[model samples]
Target: MSRTAPAPAGEAAPPRPRRRIPGLGALRESGRLFALAGTTVREAFRRPFQTRELIEQFWFVAAVTILPAALVSIPFGAVIALQVGSLAQQLGAQSFTGGASVLAVIQQASPLIVALLIAGAGGSAICADLGSRTIREELEAMEVMGVSPVQRLVVPRVLACMLVAVLLNGLVSVVGTLGGYFFNVMLQHGTPGAYLSSFSALAQLPDLYISEIKAVVFGFIAGVVAAYRGLNPRGGPKGVGDVVNQSVVITFLLLFVVNVVLTAIYLQLVPQKGA
Candidate 1:
């Protein structure tokens, strides 16, 4: 047997070598989120799917986000019309105003607006629902019963967000284009025939395809972030509130970054053609 000498009475043991790594905590959290996303994806493809839950979530998300999408899109269209029409008149290209407005809305505004609404409205709802379940020990109960909350709850919500986001993008595009048409022709005295005629002149099929893709990606990110925060909430009701706020902020930040990257790539791959 070996005898070891104890430390001096007043001396403290040397602090265990502090393991310091820049952004270690953030990296850990990010890894955990990615793992959670993987689990959700895996669950999504498994058998005995949650059809009713998916439908319910789809309806819920659509109901919560549709009105806001419409309201924002109409004004977005009007603003584009106002600005584009003013500039086009100066350049003697006023007939291009409708095309420009439609292109702008479909290419950029609708996807971003739909994403924001989903993050603010549907994402928050998911956080609240999951947080409530967490606080009530429902998640633990499911685990005890060998049931996965991820499969039951997260997958449905995520799929619903993605589906509704694409639908909402289409809705926003139509509403925004119509709003721009009304403002340009009625208010700005733009020729109706020119507005209608030039609408498809500058717009391309790729723009619509890319916009829908962006919507799907944004919705998936928002849903995942919301689910992760909600599932891992700490403290109590206040924690749930904090999680909701954080989810929205993170979703917004990620959406903007993704938008920039995707836009850059799209512009590189498919250079815009002149009308």
Candidate 2:
């Protein structure tokens, strides 16, 4: 026994060197995201409206983001209107901006902005809350208590995030449309209501479908990226801060990539320009 003890030594295996592959990492991330999305849907249905957490989450995103996004978006619309307006008139196609601008803005920009807003509020929230729990070992305690943190803590928030995303997208579109409407009134001497009616008319069923679908995908990416960063953060407040930055940056980048692909898909799937 003493000889056996002398012959045995145990040490923690060296940490595997971290490796990252761009496309592979994204594909793996996509798989993880898909699982998280399933969990999110399950938790959302399980709790139903018991917690009011979903409502609170929606309010947090919409309220916190409304002002700045409002400020940014109206002008974005006006700018689009102004530029596109001139081009449309020059090309004798001034009546067509509704479909073009509304489709582009709602399907494309709205999702991106919503992702950024959630990244600032909900994404930061997921990181800070989870990171603090991690630092204090609350998550560990849950583990000891036989609760899987992912199931207990993450699933609900992930579901709430997707719900919040829907609301956020709606908020941005409304605010942006309104702002753009006002811009047309002020800049081009067009009535806001009339301009908006034009926009509404052009915002066809397919456009709404595209916009909503984009939101779901973008929201999923934002949720998973934020969750991954929060779950894998380095120790301490400094580390949490680092993770926050990483979460936002990665989510934004992924959101953009997704937006591009979704745009391409939309073009292929939606009715052609002339049709």
Candidate 3:
């Protein structure tokens, strides 16, 4: 064992060593993130809302995400339709192909696809922009000028993400449904009347409500994750790219977990139409 060195005659004794707590850093980071999310939500409804910034960010997010989301939905819908149609046919339930395929797309694939695109495209952009500003000390400058960076900057971006995600969810559902319908009719030899009728019979308003709710929740999650990472980047300018990537990955993981939870909750709370 090693002994401590003696202090100077008139000097105070050295301080005792503090124990390190495992995962304390991680826990603190998580707490900070949740606090920031709460602050953003509360501030979002406050007056003097940044209307112009909100509009601009909304347009930017939509612009970057719309075309790619549309293109991806086409193939995603077609694949879901083809698979479900084939399976239904094997089970001698081909008449329900439309209901199965449409429900699969709307209830599952559509929100996921929208969320993926939002996090990948729009979220990455948000992270990059905020991270860049942070590295450049712009956020600090704003603070020096008596502006709350989270309020003036983060709120608009997060709100924009939510709005864009909601609108894009609707677009994706419509486009994907059409794509599924087209593929099922053409490739699977599905009857148009039966497909339409089955969908109408099986689908309920709550289905749409759940989808939109998921979109909203997913959007909020993505925006918050991106903002949190951006606002707390490491290694300065060069690390912004790394922060963006981390935000995307984190958002994706969180989205899937949240999706599962939301889907489970929805199923538990909402009764089936024919059940």
Candidate 4:
């Protein structure tokens, strides 16, 4: 058997070798985030619920995200309409421009817009608030007093994010669709009747379903990611800012990847309106 050498007086011992696995840290963080999401969901259903906290968080998230959602949606819809109109005209399928543009906005743009706004505004607020509590040891104090911070705080915020994202998805869809219609009819000289008729003929209920589902999933992801970073900020109080920025970036990346996956799966499973 090999024996380890002892350190001399007033000298520190040699550091032990650590097993470094590639991507282990990232895998561990992903696991923790998923665990946190599960805990939040479980705690969300347990009473006594944080009704007031949920309401306040919902209102606050909506307050911060509402105007931005509207503002962003208008430009997004206009661009989509213009691009689709140009393409359809080139293909001699100009009558289908409204259908194509509205479908793109509803199926793709709206949920993404809601996710970006929520992740930017609401997620940052959540991370900052929780990170401050964490650094101040308020979460620790609550644990000592027998309160589960996930139940009292995280759950409400997560629920609030979900509720607000769903509502905002609807808001963006309406505003964006109207904006697209206006741009197509007025700027592109598209007949209003043709635009409305084409949309009605091509738009299916499944498109709306997928959009709302994406919003809910994106909301849950944003809330969980922000809470995870907030609860595990490194380097003390100063690190909270870094964590907040990281959470937003991470959420944005996750949203796009998830959107692609969801869209692919929906296309595979749900048949098109006329197909």
TM-score of each: 0.92, 0.77, 0.94, 0.94
Give the worst 10-residue stretch by lDDT in candidate 2.
1-10
Model 3 off-target regions past 4 Å? 1-19
Superposition error at 270 for model 3 (Å):
0.9
Candidate 2 clash figure, as a count: 0
Model 3 lDDT tens row, 1-275: 99878998999998989999999987998899899999998988887899999999999999999999899999989999999999998999988899888988898988889888999999999999999999999999999998889999999999999998899999999999999999999998899999999998899999999999999999999899999999998998779999999999999999999999999999999997887
Go through the candidates in order and give the clash count of each: 0, 0, 0, 0
- Report the C-alpha lDDT of model 1 over 1-275, residue by residue, as the tens digit: 99657778999866667889999988998899899989998999987899999999999999999999999999999999889999999999988888888898998999999999999999999999999999999999999998899998999999999999999999999999999999988888999899877876778889999999999999999999999999988899999999999999999999999999999999999978672
What lDDT does each candidate get?
0.93, 0.70, 0.93, 0.94
How are the candidates ranked when ordered by TM-score, highest leading? Answer: 4, 3, 1, 2
Question: After TM-score superposition, what is the CA distance of residue 234 in candidate 1 from its true location, in Å?
Answer: 1.5
Off by over 4 Å in 2: 1-56, 189-202
Candidate 2 lDDT for residue 189: 60
Q: Write the per-residue lDDT of candidate 2 for residues 1-275, one digit (tens) a residue.
A: 35322333576555667787669976886687667657655654553343564456556655666677666666766676677666766787656655566666777777777778777777888877778788778888989997667766676566666776776678777776666556555766654555556666666677777788887777777777777777766868889989898888888887888788888988887875446
lDDT of 1 at 44: 93
Candidate 2 vs. true structure, TM-score: 0.77
- Weakest 10 consecutive residues of candidate 3 by summed lDDT: 41-50
Evaluate model 2: give its lDDT: 0.70
Better of 2 and 3 by lDDT: 3
Q: How large is the C-alpha RMSD of every model relative to the true structure?
A: 4.2, 6.2, 1.8, 3.2
